[model samples]
Target: MQTITSARMAAIDTNCEYLGIKRLQLMENAGAAVASAVKERISSGKVVIIAGRGNNGGDAFVAARHLGGYDVTVILIGKKEDLKTPEALHNWNVLEKTSIPLVEFTNSTFFDPSILKNAKVIIDGIFGTGVRGRIHEPESTIIDLINGSGAFVLSVDVPSGFDPDGGEFDKAVHAGLTLTFHKMKTGFLSQNAQQYTGEIRVVDIGIPIEAEFYVGPGDIQPFLKRPAISHKGDAGRILVIGGGPYSGAPALSALSALRAGADIVTVAAPKNVSDIIASYSPNLIVKKLTGEILVEDDIPIISRLIEKHDVVVMGMGLGNADETLLAIEKIVPLCTKAVIDADALSPQLVPFLDKNMILTPHAGEMKRLSGNDVPDEQKERIEFIKSFAQKNEVTVLLKGAIDLISDWLEVRANRTGNAGMTVGGTGDVLAGLTGALFARCKSPLEAAACGAFINGAAGDMAFKEFGYGLLATDIIDYIPAVMKA
Candidate 1:
């Protein structure tokens, strides 16, 4: 009995496409389901469909084709050119080839109530999960007509003008039955929802369950569509703390953060390797620590920097020096949010674990931190990761051929990376990418899922061109492209 919000449902829809299921196929299944529901009410009659310009309308268009015996007529709320989605347009084109009478109401002035006057059944598809704000135009007029028609009303997905997420709407259609796709919407559980949605029916439209469980292109959209009015550092400000023994590790992380849409990134490393790390990218804001390596003395400066940045990407290559680990133990408690990785994945840091922290660990690192063997079987491994995350009170992003991400309650997997990603510095790229997403997303699980998908997808893209010779920097270069796609 899982209920999904409109936004999360939209993400799952996109993820389904990433997994090779096209939106048009789902629309066909939905239309077939709607047509079946109509047949249940009555075999054949004059059926009038009120459709908008989105996928909701597309579903209605599909239903019209299946409703062969009945006199099915489609009343489009807008012009065919005004269709919002390609799937909707495609269905409209298909409907045009058929004899299912099509009527277009370009404006409220042109809307004829007589079309619905004879409808023995009215299918409401004017709006679905995308409805927001007050009612307007031909939609408002059509909603009223549907509610007053006294016909046996069947709402497609959600009733028109109803807020599918918050269950708040200024004006909405009252339907005798609602055929919801995929799963039940959360808003339907709201008080007084039954008044509009008479009898609710959940329809399976061929969206694979893996689409919800796996991270894909869907997870990246919300973060990428930042406000145009946003200022500097609004996207994300990341602080990378690493680079005592190896300079390249921290540099890779800082650069990857920038490519992953972090507005600003500062790499704080030991003074000895600061110059080399800084030389890697002029775009990086390098902070020089007092000594040759991370020590207890640097805590004061690091603490202040953590306060300024949105999230901390720590432990790329500080080595296992007692003094360095001790410094990390103290620094972990100061940050509100962080991505702890590599040498920072020590058992000692577990005492400070919280929901705000994300630990990125390979199988070996996970074993060391959890004091348990990383299971060989996939199901056992997934359960182990979930148990470890729940016990530690932190999100775990376990790196492997199949990346597993979990935040106590739920687990997600990403299978985007290839064998070529076994190359060095790739994990550093993931750590930094996770930090950038962690700064923007409300859920640590979502941030970790998105990070794993984007990082691995970029590697897959780079592998296509460079094969096994792909470098971590090559993956970094493709980060923005993955986000854009």
Candidate 2:
């Protein structure tokens, strides 16, 4: 019984669209399922559905049409034109043609508590799993009224005012039965959440199981939203801390970060390579360190710089010098979020592995980090990486054919790149892309999963144009196209 979290459910829904299953079809199936579930418990009554403006309300609209022999009425808490999603609004428009009594409550204080007093089976569709923070306005009042109405309550998806992720809120609708679509919520089994969730019912809404185990364009769909009033640095600010022995490595990483939708990228490197890195691209901001390589004296300033950025990319071109690894080990804990790559994959950094960090390592680095050789067989490789990542409580993106990504419990495998991707500097592009996504994604595991998919997809795109002559820069150029939803 794999419980789906709110974030994972969103990914699965997007994958359904990518697989050509229309959103309207899924909503129709969900509404039909709710109608069947309601009929099994209460055959006839003055059924009142308190629907919000989201997709949950759309489900209620569909259910109202199929609830045979029942008097169904819809109470929409917001304006029908102000619906949140396109599918929800479409259903609302269709409901207008039916004879179902439609009651609109636009403001918080207008709806009367007596409206639901006669409800024998009140459907609670006021809020779904998408809500966060405290409950406000007419919805909060509605939650209380539903709890006290003494009606046989049925919640669609999640109960109104209840956190689907299991966090306790101020007020929540206490329902007799809850019909959740697809799979059971991960939080529904929490301590007191079942009290409000009642008898949990998992309904199949026709989403393919392949969508749950694979990575596709749907994984990056959340990054496509950009509010018009958003300012600079709102997208992401990344700091690249590398480039001592190799001049080109840090520049490639910094440039790739900018191409991956990061608003700001700063490359802080040794003095010998700082000017060369800055001269390669005008999009990067280069900061010069005191020494030619990472050293003990640079820890204080690097720590301060780590605090300024949203995410940090460390160890691209910083050769495996003793002093360089030492600097990496010290500065990693200071970062808010990070992508640890290249020469910094020292075994000493194992203690620093956690949910906030992502370690992108090739076969050799994986061997060093785990104190074992890279296994030849696919199953052995997955078990080794999965076990080690779980033990350390960190997200590991082990780079190889059929890239394995794990955060101890859940693992995602990626198969998108070609043999032409076996070139130098391609991994650096992956590291920078991981950094840019880590700043915006919900978790480190999600960012690393997206990184592997996008980086490999871009490599395949470049390989088509250049055959075996694909340069690392060619992959970077195709990233934006692959990232577009």
lDDT of each: 0.92, 0.87
TM-score of 2: 0.81
> 373-403 in candidate 2: lDDT tens per residue?
9898987887888888879888999998888
- Mark the regions of model 1 whose C-alpha exceeds 4 Å error after superposition: none
Which digits, one per residue and each the tens of the lDDT, describe model 1 over residues 1-485? 77999988999999999889999999999999999999998987899988899999999999999999998999888789999999999999999999888988886446767888878899998998988998987677778888889899999999888788755689999989999998999989888998888899999999998999888788778977887699999999999999999999999999999998899999999999999999998899999999988999999899899989999999998999999999999999998999999999999999998999999999999999989999989899999998988888999999999999998688899999999999999999999999999889878899988999999999999999999999999999999999984
Q: Estimate the Cα RMSD of every predicted model relative to the unseen true structure.
A: 1.5, 4.1
TM-scores, all models, native as reference: 0.97, 0.81
- When summed lDDT is taken over every stretch of 10 residues in candidate 1, the lowest stretch is 104-113
> Cα deviation in Å at residue 326, candidate 1?
1.7
